[model samples]
Target: MRTRGFTRCGVIFGLSVVIVRLIGGSTGLVCYTAVESLDLGCLLRWDCLHASPNITYTVQTKTQGDPWQDVPWCVWISSRSCDVSHVFSDFELYNMIRLGVHLSPSSTVWIKPHKFDYSDFTFSPPSVSVSLKNDSISVKVQFPCATNRRCSHDACCPISKLIDPWTTVTVYNERNRSDNQSRTVWTQEVVSTVEFSGLSPGQNYCAVANFSFPTFSIAASPKSAPGCVETGSRWGMLPMYCVGLALSLLFLVLFLAGFLRKPRRDRTTADNPPKPLATVQDADSSAPPIFVDPCDIHVELVDDHSSIDSFHGFHKAPTSGAETKRSSQPTHFDHSRGVTVQHEVQDMTFESYN
Candidate 1:
C-alpha cells in the first residue's frame, strides 16, 4: 500500500509540473535575427515571434576567442534592432564576430557568428542619375560606399570590392512604359557613368540600376530609384548654332565696315582741310571795333623861327615841301593870344605861349 501511495505521489508531481509549464508558456524565446553592414554601421535586427511588454532584449558582441561584452547602447531594450558597430570598431576586417542576445525574464539565445569582411555585408541599391544628350542618355550610378567613412579611410578600398563589379542597367521609354534596352556594364572599367547611344531623340527615357554578384551568390540589390530625362531633338541646337554664327558674321561685318571706313574718313579730312584762322569772321558784324592805346608817340616840328616871329599876332606858317606833300595844307598858329593851334594830320601838337 505504501508503494502504491508513492507511485500516486509521483504521478501527481508530474501532472503538477505539466500544468505549471502550460500556464507559464514557452521557456525559450523564439526569434528571427539577421546582421548586416550598413552605411552608418553594423546593424542587428530581430523579429521575436513571442515577444511581450515584460520581455526586453539586450545585444552583446565579441570577437573570436574574446569574452562577450554587452553593447552599452543596446542594453535591455524592447526595440527590434540595434547597432553593434561600436563593438567592432577596433576589430580587423577578417576577424570573426560573435553576436548574442539576452531576454529579460526569459532564457538567453545566441545567433551564429559572421566574418567582418566587406563581401559579407549587404549591398545597398546604387544611386542613379540620368541625363539626355542629343541622341543619347547618360546614366550615373553612385555606390553606397563611395560616401562611407570606412571606405574613405582606406585608400586601396574600391566600392567594387564591397559590391558587385557587374552592374545591370535598364532603360525604359516612358511613352510606351516598357523596357527599351538593357546593358550589363563592368563598373570597375566604366567607373560610375555609362552612356547609351543610338537612342531616338526627343523621347523621354528612364533608367534603373542594380549590382549583380554571381561569384558570391549574392542576389542583385534592389533597383535604384528611377532617373528620367528628355532627350533633345537632333535639330534642336541647330537654330542656336545658326543664330550664334549669324551674330558672329554680323559682328565681323560691322567691325570690317568700321575699320575700312576709318582710312577713308582720314583721307577725306586730309583733302578738305579746315579754313585758316586768319580768314575766320565773327558771327556779329555790327559790333563795335576795339581801339588800342599807343604805348609811345613822337612829334616832328618844322624849323619855323621866322614863322614864329611873324606869328607875333597870328600867322599861318608856310608848309614845308614835305609837309605840303604829306598834308596838302599849312598848319596855323595863334601867338598873340598865348595859344598855338597846329593843324597836322599824322601827329598834331599844341603849344602854350604864355
Candidate 2:
C-alpha cells in the first residue's frame, strides 16, 4: 500500500522569493552630473572709466560690436594736450563715440588691442576615455558627440569594444571663445560615456577620450537595460542552508524533549492504577473476628479470695503432725451448684493432677 507523508513546501517557495529580491536589488544606476552644459562665447571683459570730476573735456568712447577686432587708430582731446593711441577699427564703426578722459595733470594714454580669429580654432573631444573590464560581467555603453558638427574627422578617437552598442548618440555644437565668458550661454557638458556595461563580443562601441579634463565620472543609465550578473549557487544556498538547519534543530529539540519525557509519563501511568473498594453491609455479621496484635501489652490478675479458709469456706485443724500438715495444705476445689474456680497461683507456673 502507498502512504502519504508530511511535507512543507511553502518554505522553499518563500526562500526562492527572497533570493530573487536580493539579486534584483543588487543592480542600479547613479546620477552624478545634473548640469551638462558649458556656455558659448561671452564677453570676458567690458569696462568704462571716467576721468576727473572737473568739467574737463571728459572725452570717453564706448566700443561696441565684437571687441576682438584689429585696426590702427588714434584719438585727440581739444581741451587737453593728451592724445590716446592704438585703437581698433571694430570700435570706430560706431557713430559719435563718447570718450571719458580723467586728467589729473594732462597725461597721454596708450591702448593696446588684441584680437583673435575664429578661423584657426577647432573643437576636439576630450583626450582620455575610461573602460572597466571584468571577467564575469558584461556592459553596454554609448559615446554621444556633437550631432550637428562633423565630429568624426578627428584622428584616433578611441572607441569602445567593437561589439558594444550605443543608443541616443547625440552630438552638440562646440562653444566659441565668447561662450566661455558669458553669464548665460548655450553650454553643455562634454559627456564621454553615456552608458557603461559589460563587454560583448564583436561589438563596436565609442566613448569620448577627454584631452584636458582631469576628473571623470560614471553613472547608471537613466533607462533600464538588461542587467544580469551570473551569481553562483553559493549565493542562494546560504539562506536555504540556514532555514534547513533551523528546521532540523527545531525538530530535533521537539523530538528529544518528547523522547526524554515520554517514559516518565508512561511510568507514572504504570505506577498508579485504579483499585477496587469494599462495600459495608448492614446485617451480615457472622464473620470470624480477626485479631491483630497490639504493639503495647500488659497483663492483669484477678484473685477471688486471699485467705485459705475464705477460699475453701471451711476451718482448718491446727496440728503439727505430718498428716495434719498435709491436711492443712491449701487445695484447689470446685464449688457446688456447678461452680468452677480458676486458681491463679502466685507462682508463675501451676501444676494440676486428676
Scored against the true structure, residue 147 in model 1 reaches a CA lDDT of 27
lDDT of 2 by residue, 121-164 (tens): 11223232333343222232222322111224364222221111
Model 2 accuracy (lDDT, Cα): 0.28
Task: Assess candidate 1 and give its TM-score to the true structure.
Answer: 0.45
Model 2 deviation from the true structure expressed as Cα RMSD, one decimal place: 29.5
Distance from true location, Cα of 151 in model 2, Å? 36
Q: Over the stretch 229-257, how does candidate 1's per-residue lDDT look in tens digits? A: 98887688789899999999999999999
Error of 2 at 206 (Å): 18
The per-candidate count of clashes, in order, stands at 0, 44
lDDT of each: 0.59, 0.28
Q: Which candidate is the best by lDDT?
A: 1
